[model samples]
Target: MGGLATAMLGCPGMPELPEVETIRRSLLSRLEGRRLVAVAASGSPLRQPIQEAAWQACVGARLEDLTRRGKYLIGHLGRHAAVFHLGMSGRLLVQPASSPAPAHTHLTLGFSDGLELRLVDPRRFGVAVVMPAEEVSLYPPLARLGVDPLEGDVEAALASLAGTRAPIRNALLDQSVVAGLGNIYANEALARAGIRPTTPAGRLSPARRARLARATRDTLADALAAGGTTLADGGFVDGDGNGGYFAVALRVYGREGQPCQECGAAIRRAVMAGRSAFYCPRCQR
Candidate 1:
């Protein structure tokens, strides 16, 4: 079982972009074309202040599109939309109108088809609020974020990569350097790039930087293609309540002490910026 490179990572907490994007794709079917019959804000406010009245703005509007930026979900209605950040432990599940709402459910969006979408987060880090559709672009968090990593400016990312002395893994995790990456993905991408997780970002050769950029895209694409990774404790899942299977395809994330896929060297583990980093010491750097 430990011989594989893509073993499931045991760390579970805040989800990265791939997980959030998977939700957006799955939710599009359940949300688009469905009119919001009602919106009820229950329980405490999530990460962002949950405006009970602002949610009312979505009532009667049709959920036309579901888009994702980094780790945020944008539910579009023609003139307005709702912004959702799943923070840690946030589960946006679709259930029948007759289905009992789960505990910690803070926001509920009832649709015209007798279905309901609920935002349930035990840690209460998720956010859901309806606002002017165009307002998503002006929102501070989304606006201030860096490159999209998947389809964003590559030259800009390379420039940032060339300018930072921070640990390569840490720099990748910076939303301001490259958006949508978390600790686990950072380690995965670095492993894919064949760059040591602790290598200084600015010290990478031109070839290494290029590989890092391509590795980031390729690794993320691989994860998305497989539906995203779901770790232990199940912090991430598709909108339909199913966990992603990408975790088993991981290259080096959370494989400490296991044999490397490219080399027989045992995978090493380290703590960077208080987050776990897994890499094949012989394969990387």
Candidate 2:
């Protein structure tokens, strides 16, 4: 593999918390208070099949709010809400109704306005479901999710993994330990905290754990501000279908063999659980 390709070896294709949150914020203005005038499904199956009856219930309902739980987007509509998870390579796009529907458009929701919200996923791993708004927290995916690293006490959340022998990078990827974290940011956060990705979660000292937690939040905040990372292959976009630019700010996630900004040593990459973990050899210990 070439330099950049080799460096991006194990970065996940799935959208993480920052990407999802960006989508939520972008869609909120366009979708909130707008009545759903039409709804359609292509009968294609995703991670789970698109529930037609569930979506049909959303017709004529007004979107009151849009929120994020982990990597999922929940749009509140009166008594019901639509929940969406952009599994690998899925995108929720907002475009003028006059525009031709993009290929692989599995679901289309037309609002009272002239715009349409479409779910396009060529890989068919995304999810779209609707249920009572009051029961959203009880939904299986949201119910099982751990604390939001940005919203909750991430240090406490990391405390739960203190007993696990797995590498700290692997532990961060656990949705039950810190919801919304993906492989890329996990590695970047470790790099920021000056810790090796392969360090055992259980072996981290209390001070190190606190530092990791802070670094994780800071990494996410920076990514969120940059509109999230869009890699060459992943093609992540916001609600308006604009791409993310955080890739330029990445420190070590995909810069294998590049000089560490901190210490002038070449960055390194290691394969862990089928994913690549990038770090600065001289700076991280």
lDDT scores in order: 0.82, 0.87
Root mean square deviation (Cα) for candidate 2:
3.1
* TM-score per model over all chains: 0.93, 0.95
- Candidate maximizing lDDT: 2
Where does candidate 1 stray beyond 4 Å? 1-11
TM-score for predicted model 1 compared with the true structure = 0.93
Point out the worst 10-residue segment of candidate 1 by lDDT.
1-10
lDDT per residue for candidate 2 within 178-285, as digits (tens), equals 899988899899999999999999888889989999999999999999999998776689999887888888899878899999898999989888778899988899
- Name the runs in model 2 displaced over 4 angstroms: 1-8
| lDDT at position 77, candidate 2 | 87
lDDT of 1 by residue, 48-156 (tens): 6688777777778888889888888988876887888987679899989898999998998899989999888887767787778778799888888888888896445
